[model samples]
Target: MDLVDIDDLSVTDLGAVLDRAAELKAGSGPEAGTSAGQPLDGQTLAMIFEKPSTRTRVSFETGMTQLGGHAIFLGPDDIHLGHGEPIRDTARAVSRYADFIMARVFDHTDVEGLAEYATVPVVNGLTDDAHPCQTLADLLTVREKFGFDSHVAWVGDGNNVCQSFVLGAAMVGLDVTVATPEGYGIDDAVYERAAELGDPPERTTDPEAAVADADVVYTDVWVSMGQEDEREEKLRAFEGFQVTTELLGDRPLMHCLPAHRGEEVTDEALESDNAIVWDQAENRMHAQNGLLVWLAERS
Candidate 1:
């Protein structure tokens, strides 16, 4: 099975993964701390990146090593997919050489095509449409800071990260309120998917209202990679949407980084004691480590 989206795993499976992630972080589980009995010993993961990254690449590569496995990084220049080779061909070739494949690509269909053709399990590290891996790590971090019952307020563009978190939070029964500019709201399909799981996220145009009673407040860059041309327009649209210290109001802040500090959030809010952003970043490895182990067992 491939984890290309948040709903690919059931609530029970997600719970188990988060529990295992905690155990991995605490260094108490059988697969913890570069131990000899590592579950992924001798395994290999092929990482294909169509876009630049810091956390996704490093976390997955390091997570493989900690699990006693190896990871091979393939950048856009190193891959044939951009040279007109079919995704199916590349997927088949890579599956034969590696135990698993993780792809961070611009097009969502690239990973979908990989999963469709690869014999091994394919993981979507990130895409334009969804970012399930990041959501998984975010969920783990949120669970640690404030249990599942806590309310989360998202204040920024309803991009890939927001859409994925909306689905994952609903699956875990967390109340989520999203505030985006009028034209920057999440896709209708995302709402439909979340509603299928449980309650759809509350939508609004006021960031303050969204975070009013929130236990945690989250935001991301107003303009993501490939959207540089729209930066000025987006900035104008997001005028009052910045997560300043005043906006946070004692609620813990979370940002899937590479934050445009002055744009989506203020330095005071990001560097304050209430910012769990670093913990959220560190949890990426632990959460993905647990996920790799789970996927290996099933595969």
Candidate 2:
């Protein structure tokens, strides 16, 4: 099965996946260790990257190694796709060698295409439209901080992270309020899907209003990769959208890192006791470990 979006799985499936993640987080050894080796002892993973990454690369590569599997990193420049190879051909070829395929790319369609043609399970590392794995880690962190059924308030660009969060919240039945700049709201399709998952979310343009009484206030870089040209304009447009202490107003805040200290979030806010930025970052490892194990068991 491919994990392209949260909607692809049922609530029961999500619960099982998360429960397994929690189990692994609580002190389970490498899944393969139980049998005297890695859970994926003979498994091979082909990791395709069309974008630069630090977290995705390190986490997946190390996760695979620890799980008794090997991961081969395929950069855009090194792949047949870069040399005019069709995506279908690339997917079929990689599937022949790899037990699973993980891709970090610019277009969501590319990930979907790979899943379509590849016989192995396909994982979405990231894309311009969604970052499902990151959202998985974020939800696990929220579960740690506030327990199950916690509400999250997102204040900033309704970008890829926000889009994934909406779907993640819906899958877990957690309430979410997203505050984005006018004309920068989540894609209509995402909004529609989230609404279908459960009660319609509370959407607004006022960041402060969204965070009031919120358990977790989340924000991300105003300008994402490929958006460098809009840095100045986005800064001006997102001025009041910053997750400052004032906006947080005693609410705990979370930021996905490589953060711009003074832009999407303030240094003061990030350093506050209520901030769980570091813990969230650290949880990425544990959360992804759980994911790998879960996938291995199912595979």
Provide the overall lDDT of each model, using Cα atoms, as 2-decimal numbers. 0.91, 0.82
Candidate 2: C-alpha RMSD to true structure equals: 2.6
Model 2 scores a TM of: 0.93
* Candidate 1 C-alpha lDDT tens digits along 1-299: 89999899999999988888877778744555445247899999999998889999999998999888999999988995635888999999999999999999999998999999999999999999999999999999988878889999999999999999999999999999999999899999999999999889999999988998789999999999999999889999999999999999888999999888788999889999989999899989989998998888886
Model 1: weakest 10-residue lDDT segment is: 28-37
lDDT of 2 by residue, 1-299 (tens): 88887566677877777776676566545643543136677788888998878888887887778677889999977885525887888999899999889898888998899889989888888899998888888888888778757778999999998998888888787888999999888999999998888755689998877887578899999999999999998988887898888888777888877799988888999889989888787666666667667777886
Q: How many backbone clashes does candidate 1 have?
A: 0
Clashes of each: 0, 3
As a whole number from 0 to 100, the lDDT of residue 68 in candidate 1 is: 88
Q: Which segments of model 2 are wrong by more than 4 Å?
A: 28-37, 80-83
Model 1 alpha-carbon drift over 4 Å, by segment: 28-37
> TM-scores across all candidates?
0.96, 0.93
- Clash count for candidate 2 is 3
lDDT of 2 at 191: 90
